[model samples]
Target: MQRIDRFTRRSLLKSLGVGAGLLPMLEVEYAQAQVPAPRCAFIFCWPNGMLSTSAATGWPAPSATAAGITFKAFQASLEPLRDDLLLLDGIDYRFLRDSRAPENTGHACNPGMLTGALFKAPGTGTSSIVAGGASIDQYIGSSLVNLGYRGLPSLNLGVFVKSTGRLSWRAAGDAVIPATDPYRVFDEIFKGVPASGGTGTPTPDPTVTRNRSMKKSILDTVRKDLTRFNLRVGTEDRKRIEAHLSSIRALELELDRQAMPPVVVGSKPVLPPGVNTAISENFESTTNMMIDIAVAAMAADVTRVVVLQLGDQGNANVILSTLGYKPAGQVGNTGNFNGHHAIAHRNAADKDKVDTWFQS
Candidate 1:
């Protein structure tokens, strides 16, 4: 096999007319490429679970042949890429089911769904809960890093807030908080990429280089001060100071790395202007922006693992009124459903509609 680096692989894919939107169709072809192609794992997580009660509920009906599985009716949104979809059924996180109290099952399942482990029991007087181990995405990302893949270990992108139910965990208690801001994510991943029309060995912008040097110098000074200050502080304070210093050092290293010339494959993507990077009131727009950034990051080979948390379990903030669905109503009274979580718990019909919207 040809040992192609990340840039070469990306260039080859682009030359073959590959684009971010066509990623699903090209997945298999990428794996079979003669060059050592990049391998990406995407985890798209949604809350409230799917309506898998039966074929009538929009779940893929059981089929004797591969051609028989169909994304129809409620699953019509997936029709365009039905051939690329992989539908798995009859899977459960037994450990989570066994360990969680019956009352906590719904929310508790969120963390365990991806990690496949029970949630850690909170200590007395503590309300926090965490996954028992690293989630599958993180596990795969760490393995890829160990195999010498450079760039970010993983990209956790989400439209939800940090307080939302997390699906990606770095460890038993460490939830990987996603970056909700699309511009920030793009900056973090693609800022160093060479601009279009540049020569093969693109010159580092003097302003960028100077800014990085200044940041590194500032961090170095802060680290030295923290080291001297540590001796005067108590154990707990000293530990905190050390942790802060460690983060500074990491940032310094990242700055140094970014100062080096980027491995350009082809023309870099133009940053989308006027994008609302901050969390937006419009959920759909925010989500689309995040998806765009995630796709671009993968295309640039910035990260091979991406975990997208679509929404949190029991979150009532997402409003689907714009999607043309009738507002969720109470048992009898007619009104827009209070929120997504309320609609989710109303009945199977509501859940199916919401799930289908998400899949779409």
Candidate 2:
């Protein structure tokens, strides 16, 4: 597939609708290529740190602290987008230690990172961990002046995460649990999006499934404009655009694969065979699916704000062995050490391997 740059992809996204598979007709002008994609903010909460030990304070990426033009070997995974990345390392989370919230570790750090609010401790009545303020996602998502968009205010998805260490906070005392199930999230975001006469595509409105066909591929939906678009671009550019479209088509198939009609088992509806129902198993695929859905949601203008928390504090909710990384307790390879979180505390060397995968 042709690797499109962020700006180019977004610029093209304004003219494309690959997520919901349906868009309004275009206004019949080449100027649509110049339209900027909907602006979005994505926050990825990694399971834990790359630090040699749990006691480490800041990120070890050299480019983050020392002003540098290149990503170090430690950041090999980000090397592809090195030029596009802004390494603002060493930005202290001082708000975590303010009067309202004192800095803590283990189960407490995730809350204050984005919200700047202290974690409200459990008391006589309230028995859950909650941030005392709205995290940036909700803060900006709710702002009509800033990001008043047509779709959801924010879409939060996760991979194998559990109820604890929730990263997104909707408001004071409201810890927004991320949607860990990708299939459900995909359906909720891409289910209904119809065109109003097919001249130009309307933004994806999750609330509108009234009169639209839910089965047409996005390529089919935009076939008319796509042909027109092909006629205008240079031959080489057209080839590249075609490759990009192929990827979109693949994404469409993937959505369909997982969304197969649910089967009733013992009077209970269960996901189809293709869906990754057990997020903890085949986790690598599950994680990728969630991310793909996230990007598609933003690309389709389903939502302007998306948060993909890699995992919960267990970080153990998902088994790491699927990716070939064994956890700490797998003595002789027949045991069940599911998560790599324990490794970070026990042996930094083993944890470094997991860290490299995340950074890379």
Candidate 3:
């Protein structure tokens, strides 16, 4: 009986071919299995408005003499991406234009831009107004979830936007609040994966037993097998394996850095101290950070759809000076246009300049 048992075990081990030693190679193969890249949709919403002109500006105009459209100077920046660009002209949101409040057109149009429904304005004022239905992004995101998207359905990110000014709505009155902090967004996207060099194992002090001992034994064997396999692999294969391992290590290091608390400099911290406060209050930096996080989340398959609201319509406080433009003074008969919102309401020249900067 003992001899028969020994023979059975030996046959099983040989059948496995390298037995436990094959685990490392299997691990590498499993890691290399190409997960089909997730299909992504990104909606970038900007505030105020855009320039619509057929003249010196880059805006395209329907040709009077020719069959095709004519592009102007302002669109020169978009020349490289001209093939990919889709220009939709004369498409107006009739809902906003014909809404109940004719006086508060901009405010009403902000929430209704993506939703395609009139804003449900509160009896009191515009402060409590909300979208009348789910926005397009939300509908697409929900549909994707139903179609078996395993990751987060959507990521709503915004800069200088309030809940009232949100572009994505889940329902008539349900506004999806965005994560304003870049660090928090980063942490949320990478919450589950183990940090670099972290044992990722809970303390075994209280539950240490024979089972734990067996697990340790198996892990030690796996490590030894990995080392032996590494020695036998060719230079090219070794390099590939090393590169993957290095990527894993780098990811861990980044996680560790993100987890670290802000370093104090003199009286205040170098980074934003409050979780509520944005990582950077500067419009440019905040927009860039949100975009970076959105890209990272999409690449990691954390979310298939992302709606990035650059600024709220009413409160789009973009510092025009940063774009090398002095505040709009009276141009011929135009009045003083102080801020972005004011400039947007000015003559076509001012609006076109702002729009060009935004396009760039």
Candidate 4:
């Protein structure tokens, strides 16, 4: 869970030969200096309305919060994932009402989920103000770029949706589109920058090559500049530049890593023929595939940050069948019980059905 904290900038720099045996001395001197370390990706996804009682476990033991949302038996599906998840409750998005749009609008939270901007138009038709700004993923990507991340810093992925909403407002609060297709997304990641040793036919675009060359030129210039400043600047300023150089080199390595194309997760694994894209045929397979992809992205270190929308607003219903609750015969006897959307409605009234659902 805390894998992100395992590596610090100072330690990473020390490993890269910044100073000879100077780390321990510095560590003793300034043990609490705030260093600019690599920020991992933050993934956020809420496809359907959460069945508070069914999805979340209540306060500790028997009587914690007393009357807040609690996890009922129905949340068994999430049990395996609980440790990796933080099930927050009682948090309301009331700040969204500041907009002039009519209050209590349709699927209002969808637009505001990442942007934190109020939707100003009616929710009917395409009348909503859409998202007022870039979503969190986009903001991080843009900031990384400004901080000198030239390669893809963030990845927004979804199925059956345009990449637009993947990005929230970053440039003047506009939407930053997401990348939907795995194939296309993979290509974009490897588009520029040929394979190491210039052995591949995937030649980078001339413009892209020029841009990279220019970046190299700037780094060269900065290195020269730092040399000059070393003679003129104070000791503290020199240390700062050294730190910056260490960070820059780390970033360069990261960029190179990002440039390498990701092989399909199971490329080397033996699989039955015709098993490719099994998740695309229907809901169950697709959800499994999405989860698989998310996990793969993490294991591959392909942008530590990610956000997965199960589906658009009201789209969680689309997955109800996948869970074996709707569309009988679609998933054998398992997926035929009841619609996933109905589970919440049932939980609101009949407790017996819920207990049975969990126990059965």
Candidate 5:
């Protein structure tokens, strides 16, 4: 699974562009206070167990030294992020695996990864396995709420998660299915939030209503200014601004690929309907869009805790495209093998490709 967090930032700006993007644009805006950043956590999960670089795979084993974490060979794509990587070597979801979920260790251990409890594997099949307790993200969210943190208690988002991909749990037998559609997830998290970024319920005003009809995306008005600013700024600053603008484009995507208005000022954000999130090739944008929305939600204080699962432990639905390198029998995508999960169980050598794709 491509880490969506690594792919978005402009969403943070657009979602905040009016809501908090600029106090000057919106009549009401969040205080630009420099309070201590809220304590938050994000979980990015994938299938086929913890990926370990074994000698058989011909990849250098990951290790952490005094300097930082190291990933050599097949995992070299992760070199730039070595310092931030925490590679746990001996961890396993064995507590419940040894008890209730011993039969189908892969699928049964899914709930145990987050909840640390004996998962419920109803009946004889692993398909019905569910978490027996709340996941850590939920636990932390509750603690944050208790500490007076506002917005959503937590967020559960997913990319191409199928029925077997259950992860975050509110309680035993009560699985919190992740929101896969980026548009829906955005609405769920940012619906009630006024573009001002204020917490109070917004009352309708005729002036504000008229402005909403005339408003286009903030980017439409700022492109030339950004370009002029880009030419005056240093190389690094220019790159940062470009990335920011690129993210805004991603966040503003529509079915017709039109630019969406930044969260409407003085009112709820109204995104256009008809987002085609079901197309296979469109999954990349969908995944990245989800990241952009999730990040914006956190940055705008819509939510503090989020769980972004690409695919469940046993149901890795991501396709590892070889780009131009198509080997025999590897039709790719959903052709020969459906996705990573199938490749994992069918071909051992190809498993590294999945890891490599994600790391890249």
Candidate 6:
């Protein structure tokens, strides 16, 4: 495949002998190509089921020391990230509230919560239910992709708890399928060419190299056929072929960018302990890294949109550990709690612990 530094639809039509009268269609393609891509990203920071209480809710009684700074229980843990977040309160999930059907209250809630349709539990029977409705992210992703943003619509990432269940959900409310392994995510971000420069079509893992070759081969086949068929084809078909070939060339150029080497995952000299020890110390560090990756992807124009989930629904206990609380056994058996959802069931009297947990 020929490499492209600058591409224009007029040049393409001239090479293919598309008629001068068809210039209007080429003008539309040129306009789209000249426009810069728009970028949008969202991160879902699920610190597990919250210990919602008065201290976690209403305005805290004013402090004598600072006028504007009011401190609540959960609000304190968020102090560091306060400026970066928009905390919305009292919005209800009518789907979960109104439906009498059994909701997948744990990790199951992760998908359904956004999809707005009740997602069938992973292994429960053969059929799935409408957990809620199509989630906002899914709707946006589909719309963007359809609008000619061939760039990745979303990058689904995670620290642990692998599966499609971690990153995102489809428009139909099915799991969006995530890349739990950092390396795989990296590959998906950049799949063609080589780690170093000078384009001899650099080497890659078998699958990676093969996918690239296959794409090129198919495009080559189309280009050859189109060149011969253009004389016989109608104006509409010629225009369609011209537009498609342009898209294929643009995609190939994006693949070339992938040849750049990946940045190493972590900067530390030694690995930390626990679930994310292999990646980083705890949920906070892992999440921060995930954000960095997403930002880079956006900056590189790799994707127009991304959905980042902090952790799985019921099993996301890393935040508990990241916030500096004991994992097990303590006064009131507080630290003994394993999962976040399990801890959220506490009554109002346990406000202190609940607030402490969220503060983490």
For each candidate, what is the lDDT? 0.59, 0.53, 0.54, 0.43, 0.54, 0.47
Model 2: CA > 4 A from native: 1-34, 52-68, 72-84, 93-96, 99-104, 124-127, 144-148, 192-275, 326-338
lDDT (Cα) of model 6: 0.47
**What overall lDDT, based on C-alpha atoms, would model 3 receive against the true structure?**
0.54
Best by lDDT: 1
Q: What is the number of backbone collisions in each predicted candidate, taken in the order shown?
A: 3, 7, 3, 16, 3, 14
For candidate 3, write residues 1-360 as lDDT tens digits: 001112222233234332211111111111222545545677777776665552544446544333254456655665554444444344455665555555566655767766656555557566566677677666666677567655565788887676566777766656777777776665555444333322232122222333344555665565556566778899976864564444334333333333332211111112343433332125666666677667655644456678788766654345455465545454332233445666776646767766766665
Question: Over 4 Å off in model 4, which ranges?
Answer: 1-39, 55-87, 104-106, 121-127, 160-167, 171-173, 183-281, 328-360
Compute each candidate's TM-score over C-alphas: 0.68, 0.60, 0.58, 0.50, 0.59, 0.52
Of the two candidates 1 and 3, the one with more favorable TM-score, higher being better, is: 1
lDDT of 1 by residue, 102-200 (tens): 335566566665555545555521125566667666666657656766656678888765474677776665677778877666665556566553324
**lDDT of candidate 6 over 210-241, digit per residue (tens):** 67668878877887787788779899779756
- TM-score-based ranking: 1, 2, 5, 3, 6, 4
Tell me the spans in candidate 5 whose CA falls farther than 4 Å from its real position. Answer: 1-35, 54-64, 72-85, 191-275, 316-338, 346-349
Alpha carbon lDDT of residue 189, candidate 3?
53
Of 2 and 3, the candidate ahead on TM-score is 2
- Clashing pairs in model 3? 57-74, 58-74, 58-75
Scanning candidate 6 in windows of ten residues, the lowest lDDT window is 21-30
| TM-score of decoy 6 | 0.52
